[model samples]
Target: MVVAACAAALLAGLTGTAHAVDNLPPDQPLVEDLQSGGKPCATGDDTVYVPTPPRLSAVLYDPEEDNQPSESSPLSGEFEAWWTDADGTVQRRDYSTITLSSGSRQYWTMPSDLPADTVISWHVRANDGHATSPWSDDGNGSVCSFVYDDTNPEQPTISSPEYPTPDEVFWVDGVGVYGHFTVDSPSDDVVSYTYGFLGGPYGTVTAERPGAAVTIPYLPLTSGPKNLTVRAIDRSGRSSSQAQYDFNVKSGRAPVARWKLDDPAGSRSAAAETGTPARAGIGATFGGPAPTGTASTTTVALDGSGHGFLTPDTSATDIRDTFAVSAWVRPAETGRTMTVASQDAVGQPGFTLGLHAQESGALWSFAIGGARLSGGAPETGEWAHLLGLYDAETGKAHLYVNGHEVGDAVAATPAEAAGAFQIGRARGTTGYRDRWHGDVSDVQVHDRVVVPTEVSEHAWRKPTLLGHWSLSSATDGASPEQSGGTPLHLAGGASVYRASDDSCIPDIDPDCTYVPPPLVGDGHLALDGESGYASAEGPVVDTGDSFTIGVVVRLADSAPAHPMTVLSQAGEHTDAFKVRYDPPTNSWQLVMPERDEAGAPERVVSQITGADGGEGPGQRLVVVYDDGTDTIKLFLDGYTNADATASLPDGWHSSGALQIGRGTVGDGWGEYLHGDVDEVQAYAGALRDEDVLGLGGETNPCLC
Candidate 1:
């Protein structure tokens, strides 16, 4: 009965077939990261940049039992990740064990706060039986960069300010007159602004519109010439050129002066703000016993080892209707709360710009004022542009991280603050505490509400660059550079074979980085099927056992005289394994010869087609066999729809050579493919759906 069933199954065209294999220990499973194309390095990228989380995949089988999963040998997987430690050392962490799920084999990355530019290495191993496979290394674990692109967006353009336009000599009016310098961000991702006199400091404001206003606080008793300077800051932490407008301010103004902390070493005062500069008071000084704060290029790099601050000549600006303060901060670490800007008296009521973290949470809190309100949003160990603003007009206060509003409230700025106005440290009651850590720069203050749009624009991604493949060569051995830096190496004598005039196109997108077709083509290899075939040393298939094969082929016009052999390993015996195409049915099939429980040899055939019934010339086909899933799946031009059960048998390895294009059927090796085969890859195990689809040409991996 079993023999006839096998004969009937073989005769049924076996577009599909399945039975069962012997109950033996499973073989070493083939493993691979789940990606499209079911092929390793489908995107030809060894260094993958993961900004968030990443996933992996593998295939399992009992090779000795015809690729079947032994009931006693279920599949389990292992993973590991490593990165540079905070102490400038390397560290590796083992991931949790993963079991094979019936749905598909995959691995997920755990949430982590790996700092930018940290190199991470991860790999996986699979065991279906007593024998475990070594870590997968089809370049999947080559390297993983825990990256947050440091590429800042293009600097913005400040369009509105034709400062001191032609014959105009600007002047600061009383009662907090608004002198907005309308700006346009080149990236169009504006977030906020900091402006005052050309060299004045801490007159920053939130950007509401294209225009960023410079408020001249009215004191009812003051007068002098003050220069107004403005800089547009985009969401991605990019800042624009300073827009300066030298202007004079008459008396009747609330005391206000920008404390640009850009002075020389131990200058004892902030940078000169055109008209007036803040001075160091009694004991108020820039670091003395501690390493004195020094100019950091354009800003100040504050070391936690000291307490340093700037005491304005007078109150920088009186707290009023709309108040704002913004600065660029790069924290050295977390845990210790610190203030970047603050104003206080002996102790009544005060406000401070700072960051805090609840002891239990991993997130850093971007707090304005005090602990009463905060947001766990600011990223640590990196540069952040922070904005704290309150709008009397809207009756709201907001805190921005990298230009995006993280928290808001129906709040108001204090009507006043006494004592010495301070920068870099909170000053209240007894003395200076909560000193700033890390580097701080571009501190500015404004007397009006900053717009959210301005904050958002500041966080835009720098340039619009897509992944690119220069289809510009015709010779093999020459390397092709990818967008970010990976090079697509040519092998198997594959060369650029297309016309440069009109051939290149993003493998997937019509709008991505598309170049002219190369003299040859992008894919490293192009085969003509029958007369042309590529042979590699034995994958030495374990006959009658389970395995998987993946291939990316583009057919030309001709129809084959027999089945189109895509990948096969066969000899005269019944223990051969083959994945080929049946031209008449327009679908791919897997033929695995296995033995039944009674020790009888049988043929197991399964059919795999696409939703579109496969394709003809000019179309690509991706076919795969997975013993783990007991299924043969086919994808047409990247879309998967058809699949069938794979009934593998037990047997020893195939002694024949692993060949692409033609295979041995019966005594004669006649199933010859007759079209162009782009890529031929064999996985000793089943491949997840994405791996197959990726090689089939559906998704494009990231270039970051």
Candidate 2:
């Protein structure tokens, strides 16, 4: 019966054997399970019925895989192994042993001498002693050798220099690849830096940089095919491996040729080392021309009739209020339509940049107060860097090229011009056309907006000329030593000057030269019957300390009825500080200087009369005194703010000449001041509130 089913499947695999019946040494034979007539089975018919086969047991040394021990690394690692009894027979007896170090198997060195958390074992003694084999249950075995760690070495993963495909030529290479890296921890601890491959062109590096590792530079691009990656970092900044690839680039060139040859004596030593200096205003009037129709000059030459250009005076003031215009162009013939700066008239809305032409030609254009902006297409002869900004609140307008932002325009309110403002031509009234052909040097006029792009790149990178003064009559002969010919550059450091009247000319002592004495409107009050002598004209002073007062009136023809006074006497007379003009409420009064009962001031008024209906004679009266503040203001042509009086008072008494057109001394019917008074100034302080709201002038003025 198939040998009783092979002895009933070999006694059912000896179910968990457990023996120790007798001492049976020298006996090892048990290879059953071959029937057909091999004996030990044949008692039953073709059926299967055979059992009995459980003898030999008793070998208790269940060392259970050599008493566990391993979980500490760093010093060259690697030591994993396991075994329960895949066929029994493991021996090494007496506390066993199994070290290893000759030529070191994997990689190690630590506290030497087999140290470094070392441990080894493999004990087993199944039948090497007497005899215990009757299903022997007294044999033993165990195995365990130590070295638990895993060595450190992973920080090398870079990919490529790709991206610039379209037949490649050149425009933007890899001027700034990625960066970072380092490795050595397992025992030599020290590794960090990770990032896989962020997004195609290149990205995805984690761990950030612990011990280090992050580089990415193979840049050779021009504009095309690109894709590079990297990874592999540890030491806490943990990161595995991932390196990618794909790249190509090439496009863009032809901007580095430079030229301007054909020396006409080397262009006259480069035009005498870039010459440009000649500004006049001190009594101006140099020879013919300059009065026919009033104002026109353009010169900053390189040859083309010098004086680059100038037109200013669009009916007097309306380039959008509080105006300013500056110039200094240099480009003899670059790219064409050159009008350095314009004001394009017709009905108003003022502003216009350089180079502009229709028929689909010429690039750079800017217009405000005339509307027209569109930048980003410039470079025609080189020497570039421009600025044209206008801001009435945020009506916003800009067109800066070298300093970035190349175009912008928005108006809820902007564009309100009134003609005349051409620097190279565009002013109307039937004359001068967009004439700017080229060569213009250093121009500037800021009633506002000059935002530092390093001061417009040091205003076109230095050609040098730090100091200049004009108001000419030919001091070009040098040495008049006049400080107020417009030479007050004490910005905020304080120490201004302009005590004019010829300042100090020829014989006011100190080596002959002291003319100061021409302010003759009312020459300090007291002019009753007029003979031009009010007991030697009393008060009319202002030696120094914040001031600005210009006059040129004509409202007399028949005075007296209390119609004149321009005081500034600060000692008694009620601390005098007047600003008069009140022919019975035709309006305008601010007198307050009375205290003469031995106390001083003999007059006081403070603020009343206010009705401006127009009073005649070249009419222009200005008053600005901030003696750091005590309150006393009034302006009309400078822009009118009307009404003021804050208890007005400030230590005063220099008793000098600042009291024009009448109001002091003998008070003689307030004579001489009936009208006609030219350009007079007393600026020492108080003058910048945007030059008292007229919106300009402050190229450095001081009052402390």
lDDT of every model, 2 decimals: 0.49, 0.36
TM per prediction: 0.35, 0.23
Query: Which stretches of candidate 2 lie above 4 Å from their native place?
Result: 1-299, 302-338, 341-365, 368-387, 390-433, 437-561, 565-579, 586-686, 690-704
**lDDT, candidate 1, 1-704, per-residue tens:** 99999998787745433332233433333433333112242222344433344444445444445443543345676666677777978877765455663234655454455565455555555655445565655343433223332333344333223233323655444323334445444544455766654334446666665333323332212236555555666533456667665555443332234544555555665664532465543223332221112123445556654445555634545554566677666666666777777666556325677777567643433333333356544435445666777655555567776555665564554545755556667765665777766666546666644445544433322211222234244234433334433333433423344433444457766766543221124433344444555554444334333333445554443454456676676554532656676767766666665632222353535565531211333444444443322345555555565344443322345666666667665555556665444433333433445444554332332212
Name the top lDDT candidate.
1
Candidate 2, 258-325: lDDT as tens digits: 11111232122111112122222121112211111112232233332333344334332354642323
RMSD of each: 33.7, 28.9
> In candidate 1, where is summed lDDT lowest over 10 consecutive residues?
287-296
lDDT of 1 at 201: 42
Deviation of model 1 at 54, angstroms: 66
**CA displacement after TM-score superposition, residue 298 of candidate 2 (Å):** 12
Tell me how far the alpha carbon of residue 583 in candidate 2 is from the true structure, in angstroms, after superposition: 5.5
